[model samples]
Target: MLPAIIASSRIVFADDALDIVQGDRIQAEIDALRMEIDDLRDERDEASLDATRRTEIRRLITDVVADAEMRTNRIDRPWNVIASADGDFTLEADVIMQYDWVLNSTSSEPTRYGFSLDTLWLSLGGTMFGPKWSYGVCAAVGSDGTFIPEYAYVQHQFEDGLFVQAGILSEYFSIEQAINPNEQLGTSLSFVAGQFDAGQPEGILVGRQFDQWRFWSTLSNGWGQSYIDPLENQRTGVMTRVELKPFGDWNTLYMFNPYPGLVDRGLLFGFGGSFDWGDYAAGTGRSISGDATRATADVSWQQDGVGLMAAAYYQDVPVSQTDGGRRWAAVAQGAFFPVSTWDVYARGEWGAVENGSRSDFAMATIGTSWIPAGDSRLKVVFELVRSWGSTADWSVDGDIGILSTDGDQTVFRTQLQFAF
Candidate 1:
C-alpha cells in the first residue's frame, strides 16, 4: 500500500513540471512574433520617407533644367518673314517680269509682243548652334509651271575659318554672273555666261576667308544633274574663285546679289575659272564626251557716289568628234553710278560656235533703283541693244541667233525688278 501511494505522488509532480515548461515556451514564441511585427512597421516607415525625398529631388531637378533651357535657347518669330524667322533666320525672295515688243522678225519666233516672267524665287536659311553651322533652301516657280529646287544646302564653318558646303548653292562664277539683273548694267547676263556657264550645280564647296581675301572651290554636277547620280548626268565639273579687297572691307564682295553701293567705299578685284568633263548629248543620235573649259576675270571699285566695274570671259568647248573642233566666247562690261539712285552701264559680247563663225552684241543701259533697307530693293532698268559682227550671235536668253531676218537687230528693252 505504501509503494502505490509513493508512485502516484511522483507521477502527479512530473505532470505539473511539464505543464510549467509548456507555458514558458508558448510565452517566448508570442514575444518573438511581436518583435518581428515591430521590425516590419519600422521598415515600412523608413521606405515611405525615402520615397518622399526622391520625389522632391526629382521635382527640384526638373525645375532647374527648365530654367536653364529658358535662359539659353529660344525660337524666333517675326512678321513679313516668309520661309524663315527674320530674327535668327533669313528670308529671301526675287520676282521679276518684263515686256518685249519685237518691231521686226527675221526667223522662226514671229509672235514678238509679250510679257515674260524672268525669275520667281523664294528662299529660307538659318544658322544654328551659333554662326558656325548653317542650312538653307530655295525654290523657284518657272513660267512653264515647273517647280525647281534651288539652294538646298548645308554648311559647316570651322574654327580656323574654313567652311564646307554641300548641296545646291548659287554663287556667281564671274563678275557678270555675280551681277543680278537689277544690279547689272544690262538687263541680263552677258552672252558668254548664257552660252556656256552652267546656272547652278549640286555638290561640295570648300571656302576660306582671309583678312583681305576670300577663296572658294566647288566640285559638282553641272546643270540638270545631281552629284548623287553617277550614270546619266555624267557631267562632273570644278570651279574656283579668288577675291582681293585691296581697299580693305570697303571692297567686300558678296557672291550673289552684289551691290557695290557708291555710298560705301572700296576696290574689289577677282578672278575665277571652271571646267566640265562629261558625256554630252547635243542633238538626236549624237553624244560627245570631252572637256568644256572657261576662264573669267573682273574688277570693281566704288567710292564717293561713283562706281566702276569691268569684266571679261573666255571659253572653249570641244567638238562633237571629241578631237579638233572648238567654240569660244568673250565679254567686257562697265557701269557708273552717277547719283544715289541713278546709274549708267554698257556691255559688249562675242561668241563663236563649232563652225568657227563669230558674232557679237553691244548695249547701253540706264537704271534707277530705290533701297528701302539693306536687303530690300526695287529698280527700273532700260537698255538699248545692237547686234553686230558675225550673223551667228549668242543672245542672253541662251539662244543662238541671227539677230533677226537682216542679220541686224535694234532692240529697246525695259525691265522692273523687286528683291527683298
Candidate 2:
C-alpha cells in the first residue's frame, strides 16, 4: 500500500512541472510575434518618406528644364544673331577667306611668284515665318576690292518636297563648280572643269528631292550672267541637273576631303545639261550668236578613308564664234587620308577643241592638305600643277591666270583657308 501511494505522488508532481514549462514557451512565442509587427511598421514609414522625397526632386528638375527651354529654345549660336521667341524666325551669317601664294613657270612667260587673295565670301541667311521659307544673300570681295555679288535669293520648300527660288543663282551644272571654293580638293578647280562651268547667273530655279533622287532646273538670263550684267548682253538659257544617291548623306558629298568622324560610304551619280540661244554680245565684249548647248556627267564615291570624283563635259558652240567647235573635256580626282586631318590628292584633266586650231591640252595636279588640330575651319594646302600640249586658243577661267604657252608649264601653289 505505501509503495503505490509514493508512485501516485510522483506522477502528479511531474504533470504540474510540464504545465509550467508549456506556459512559459507560449508567452515567449507571443512576444516574438509582437516584435516582428513593430519592424514591419518601421520599414513602411521609411519607404513612404523616400517616395515623397523622390517626387519632390523630380518636380524640381522638371520645373528647371521647362524654364530653361522657354528662355532659349537651344538653337542659339554665335552666328545666329536674331531670333523669335516662338522659334519660327532666325538670322545667320557666315564668312570664308582664302589666300594663295602661287609660283608659275611657263615656256612663254617668265617664271613669276606672287601672293593673291583668292576669295573672300560672305553670306547672310536664315529662316523666316517658318522652317520652310528661307532667304540668303552672298557676295565675294575681290583682291582689287571689287564687290562681286554671288547669290541673292528667297526660297520656299513645300510639304511635298518641292522648292523654288528666284534671284541671282548658280548654273549648278558642274559638281566642281557647285562646291564652295574652299572645299575643293586642289588649289583650284581642274582646267577642264573650269572651262565648261557656266558661272553664276540671275534666274529662277525649281527643284525637288525625294528619297535618294533629286532634280533641279533653272531658267536664267544666260551662261556667266549676273545681276549687274547689262541687258543687251543677256540671252535666254535653261539648265537642268539630276542626282541619284545610292547611299550617303548629301551634305557630306560637297566636301572633297573626308572630314573627321566620316563613317559613311556612298555612291552618287549626276548628269546635267544647258542650252542658250540669242544674238547678243557677252559681258566681256565678245560676240555670242546662234545657239550653244552644254552637257556633263559626273560620279562620286567615298568609303572609309578614300574618295573619288570624275566628270565629263561636252559643248557645241556656234560656228560664228572664234575657236568655236564641238569641245569636250574630262577630269578625274582622287583623295586619301594618311591620317586623320591630313589628306593627299591628285587630279588629271584632258580637253580638246575641234576648231581650225584644234587645240588639245592636258593638266595634272598633286596636292596635300592639313587641318591643324583636326579643325576643319582652318586648312593649309600645297600643290604642284603641270600642264602640257597645245594650250593656245583655249581660255580657262580668267581668275586662275592664263596658260598662254603651247609647251609644258608648271605651277606651285601654297594656300591658307579659313571659314566660319
Best by lDDT: 2
- Candidate 1 Cα misplacement greater than 4 A, ranges: 1-111, 179-182, 222-229, 233-235, 248-262, 278-288, 321-328, 352-355, 358-376, 390-395, 398-406
lDDT of each: 0.60, 0.81
Model 2 regions more than 4 Å off: 1-81, 228-234, 281-286, 356-358, 373-375, 398-402
Per residue, candidate 2 scores C-alpha lDDT tens digits across 1-420 of 999999999899888889999999999998998888898889999999999999999999999987777567645456446677676787788888888898889886788888888878998888898999999888999878888878889999999999999988856898988887777885677777766767677889999987798988999877755554465764788999999998987877777887657636878899999998876665556667778888999999987678899999988887666545788889999999898879899998888887647458888889999987554579998989888886665666633543666778898998898888
What 10-residue stretch in candidate 2 is worst by lDDT? 393-402
lDDT of 2: 0.81
Separate clash counts for every candidate: 1, 0
State TM-scores per candidate. 0.67, 0.79
- What are the RMSDs of all candidates, in order? 9.4, 15.0
Q: List the residue pairs that clash in candidate 1.
A: 106-405
